[model samples]
Target: MPSIHDILTKAVALHNGGQPERAAALYRDVLAVEPAEPHSLHLLGLQMRRAGCEAEGIALMARSLLLAPTLAPALFNQARALQDSGRLDEAIAHFRRKLEVDPNCGVTSIVLGNEALARGRLDEAERILRRAAALEAGGAFASRLRRALERVTTARGIARDAADPSLPPGLVVRGAFRDSSGYAHKVRQFVRHLVDAGVRVRLVDLNHGDVDNLPDGQIDPLLHTLDRPVRAKAVLSFTTPLVVEAVPNLKTINYTVFEALDIPPLWAAHSRRHDHVVVATDSSRRAWLQAGHPADRVHICPEGVEPLEPGRVAPAAILDGTGRRLADYRVRILNVSDLNSRKNLEGLLRVWLRTTRAEDDAALLLKAGKGDGASGSIRDLLARLTAETGRTLGEAAPLFLVEGKLSDTDMMSLHAAATHYWSMSHGEGWDLPMAQAGAMGLTLLAPDHSAYHAYLNGRVAHMIPSHVTPALDGYRGRDWWTPDEAAAARLLRAVIDDPDGTRLSAREHLLEHFSWRSAAHRLIGLLGGLDAL
Candidate 1:
């Protein structure tokens, strides 16, 4: 005869092992033995919900809540089920109830904000989102929230018709690839509007990667690489190298270079770099001049999110092989990044393991790309960590490694499947994925750094204090970049110990700021008006 702990542990093992039905059966058996057991009932309810039995799961969770109203898990589950069933009002009540029990529920804060958004209360939505973002200290969610707040402000500005058509055709921008992408996308929109107003626009991709499905009338690759004459009226480079390197081809009336950060080494290499440089923000411009970039060349321009299309109802690709869908991965934390020295994944793994041990049914998922020579090393390390932790590989909280580049469709599908995204990079050129996840409305854990804070603003991610050097005194891995057995165990515990209510908030954030159409328009403006401005 198995002890109660034995049975419950087995059920959790089955659930984490990708056998939800079997786990649910074990949970049911436990419930049969102890009908009012809140833990058993709650686990069973989650399994049911994961299996797409929403109503049954909701009923079970509600009953569990009745038996143990103080159970934050049950309340949170009930709320999530209600939201899944489109009962937004009821869902809000349950989320509020969960928060009432645990005010520090980061996930609940996001869900509540989403609920407010669903009710069409923009101000309430913004406030609730801001609160959620603010809770993570200086995390990705907070940065995202700041961006969201900016969007709200921008929307208001647009609504009041405060921004006018500015900049002329044939604008050029270059800089660090990521930040440049944001500005380029926005500037592209300005160009498209100009094209509609009968202006010809040319684009340049200093970054080698193809712009995913950019529409026509935008700059094509051939134009930038092949020494095509830039006949624009004005020339602007997000980085100075763009103008300095192509000065001969440029026939613009004025050459303006726009830089958002400290000047790169590439800029200093050019003597007659640019006619003028536009600085997007005052603080950033000041930093550039302080860093020795001439102050006389700087100009100020306000930056915004690349306008995106409103997300629409599309058939979400069920992540079939993973044996779990987005709905199934509820409360699961998804971390996507290259397994390298800069990421500082060990700390996140520690938090995850601790949370999982505290909660019984949690799982930590990692989706990583294979780059450099780190892939095989990471795999071997993970396997060793699992074994040392007394965890069975692919059974007791697995590490799902997805190598290689992914298409946008595949990426978005994975995004849709995640409950939360955790990123702890020491430095960020710009955490695009964090924004994408936030736009998709995923709760994020990000580091408290200037780059993330500057872009995410304050609404979408939870930011934590980061150290200049990772604390590695006790780390067993010889390399700081690799995971130690102890760290792995801690991370595993965090996922299974407690659920984060950030999933709801992530979905809501996406609906507000992430759209393809909007992104396209922004790209047009950035590229089309290079010549005139």
Candidate 2:
């Protein structure tokens, strides 16, 4: 057998070469001979972590540290593992211990600074990053540290501005404001309402791109103002609440949209980080309460809808993939959703094909987006459906898959062209498109549950009969509603029979209940209530 030194050397080499399993076996062999060998135990712990055994890795690392308390590498590795596991507070403690062991560890300082930056501790991040810069002069690490320090300085300045009393009482809205996403649309509409109501606001677009082709011009001025510090009365964050943990010394409202009954442990923790949690519907509020959040801290603030201008006509013809005009169809049914299992496109397609024949002169226009791997699945399903129905593209197949980044005007045009807006979503945080379509005076066909219940009524919507079912995908283990196929088919036929009356009623009911003015009033009241707390 080789000596411990030779075995340790080979294990280290293997570990560095990314052969963690081989390295772990060698380290275990070394430990079998000398059970308290600190190096063997530390290296094995890191290997175990790499192999996806986090708890075992942490245990081994702890034991190694017990044997050699000043093991700098072991301490650093443990801290990194803890941080990766979202045990940020524990990670900070471990990093502090590592610094104590090796006071001049520049890499440790940089890591600590980065962790601080992630946690939104700007002052601490700047301090540690400056120390890292001093320790690592004239190197890549030093250059990186300097850049990080500059960012920290800028962030600190922004935080200061956020807390400034000199500026008018305003709101700083942070979210994916530029994307063609539901969240982005909600933020855009809400910001528009605030501005229209004569309130001061600044937008922090987190979508990481230039704001292009957004529907409203109000977002234009805010885009150029992103680089400036935001001095606002409050920060309303539409992003995940986990971000609020980094933003200290401000009253933060966590604006979240939860589709399921049960909240995940991680999300619940993030929700508690904010001063208040604003949910889109009463069902969402109940979910937070069930997840152990304080009832007083969770408030219901439903989203608003902006209808398209009246008298706007759809294009005379929409070009299909082959550039052929699909204008022969008499009726258009529009379904806009991020193509995913939750949207239940599979079920929707099945029901549509089963209900309407090719001779019905109706087209199902699927305006789908936002799924990374969902396009392939959608194509496959469409192909299967086409074969089953014996329909060719654009003629026998009455389905058009429209996928791209659509402008607001383009979206409104699609809604205007459609005779009915349809969805069979398993769940919804708040189905923005459904509400928008309703506001646009388009007849709706959706389940009468979740966020739909907040606005959809018999007066406006043809509520499809649905049964409760287990949620799919990210909402696993929670209950959601699935629309009855036969009932949906009946509703689809009913809407086609009386399109104008159904559209008028839907538009009236949606405008009465889901207006931006109402949402903004509720929001302003909620912000005022936060002050009393």
Per-model TM-score, in order, reads 0.45, 0.73
Task: Go through the candidates in order and give each one's C-alpha lDDT.
Answer: 0.52, 0.75
Clashes per model (N, Cα, C within 3 A): 90, 0
lDDT of 2 by residue, 285-307 (tens): 87788889999999988898875
User: Global lDDT for candidate 1?
Assistant: 0.52
lDDT of 1 by residue, 81-183 (tens): 7765646568778888898999887678876665443233457767877777768668646655564454444323322221223523233432222221334
Single out the weakest 10-residue window by summed lDDT for candidate 1: 473-482
**For model 2, the run of ten residues with the poorest summed lDDT:** 207-216
Score candidate 2 by TM-score against the native. Answer: 0.73
